[model samples]
Target: MPLWSLWWAWMAGALLLAILEVVAPAQIFLGFAAGAAGTGLLLLFGLPGLAGSLPATILVFAVLSLIAWLITRRIAGVREGQVKLFNHDVNDN
Candidate 1:
């Protein structure tokens, strides 16, 4: 069986991504971690289509990652005064 067919591998990947998110805390890897977890769950449940096709599984993962990222962004929007607008370059003298 291809490595993708193994659900545990995906879960392991999710765990790694979660760890990265913790280390970075930039709200980036968490979405990917979520996607990996979702894919793992689908594989664990014996999703026939995902189990047989690498491309399809990857596509699903990408879609899930995108959706999760969008949701995360929406939930944790930019904080007030987060943006710093500078009219003059610091090096300009």
Candidate 2:
């Protein structure tokens, strides 16, 4: 397949995976979605080289996702002292 077509396919897959992530909210597929979107953008811009770009794209996506997650956690007040799993407080007072 041509480069453009391949990029489109990746974008489509990414969109689908993102939608699934939304439904599931497991925070797994978003990284892949970001990677695919980045790759699609790069392909659309007609970059100088295509070889080894997939790995680079994936790395970029992973880094970006990690940063985003950290920022979100901070904004959401997720501190190390708080229990994140199965810890719901009930108002009994």
Candidate 3:
């Protein structure tokens, strides 16, 4: 019961973030949700040394969150066409 609690926390955090992402479309919360969910899956596998160190766990979370954020930005920032520019002033004859 106690050991599984940590994974539960991660899973809960992921779900919360996913909900937030839907409520607010900032495109970042989804990334966070992905990171948290991935971390939770990792922790579930009983990785050595990851579950023992608080600092390492926090660092991993931060790194994963950052990576997720970057990937989200890259995917969401795509542009297909160039903006039109004009040198003439409007209403000028």
Candidate 4:
């Protein structure tokens, strides 16, 4: 059995990432944490062929992370004035 196939490992990683998110509060690690937890659940609940390979598991994690991140971003829309675009360089003076 590969290490990556262990549901506990994924859940532990998810917990750590969730803690990091709490410490930073940037909403970045949260998505990853979600993805990890999802993977862990799938593993624990028995997903067909999920425990058979490493690449497939990783691919699932990546896709889950991306989807979670996108959903989080949409729900948490950027705050006003969060970005500052400077059209002129100060060195131009």
Give per-residue CA lDDT, model 3, range 1-93, as digits (tens).
344337668889999999999999898898888888877877888767777777776777778888998899888854567457788989888
The regions of model 2 sitting more than 4 angstroms off are 2-5, 51-78, 84-93
The deviation in Å at residue 14 for candidate 1 is: 0.3
Candidate 4 structure quality by residue, lDDT tens digits, 1-93 = 878999999999999999999999998899999999999999999899898989999999999988999899989959778887999999997
Output the number of the lDDT-best candidate. 4
Task: Tell me each candidate's TM-score.
Answer: 0.84, 0.57, 0.75, 0.82
RMSD of each: 2.7, 5.0, 4.6, 3.6
Q: Compared to the true structure, candidate 1 yields what TM-score?
A: 0.84
- lDDT score, residue 9, model 3? 82
| Of 2 and 3, the candidate ranking higher by lDDT | 3
Q: How many angstroms is residue 71 displaced in model 4 relative to the true structure, after the best TM-score fit? A: 0.7
Q: Provide backbone clash counts, one per model.
A: 0, 0, 0, 0
Q: Which ten-residue region of model 3 has the weakest summed lDDT?
A: 1-10
Best by TM-score: 1
lDDT to native, each model: 0.92, 0.64, 0.80, 0.93
Model 3 misplaced stretches (Cα beyond 4 Å): 1-5, 78-93
Where is the poorest 10-residue window by lDDT in model 1? 75-84
Task: TM-score winner between 1 and 4, please give it.
Answer: 1
Better of 1 and 2 by lDDT: 1
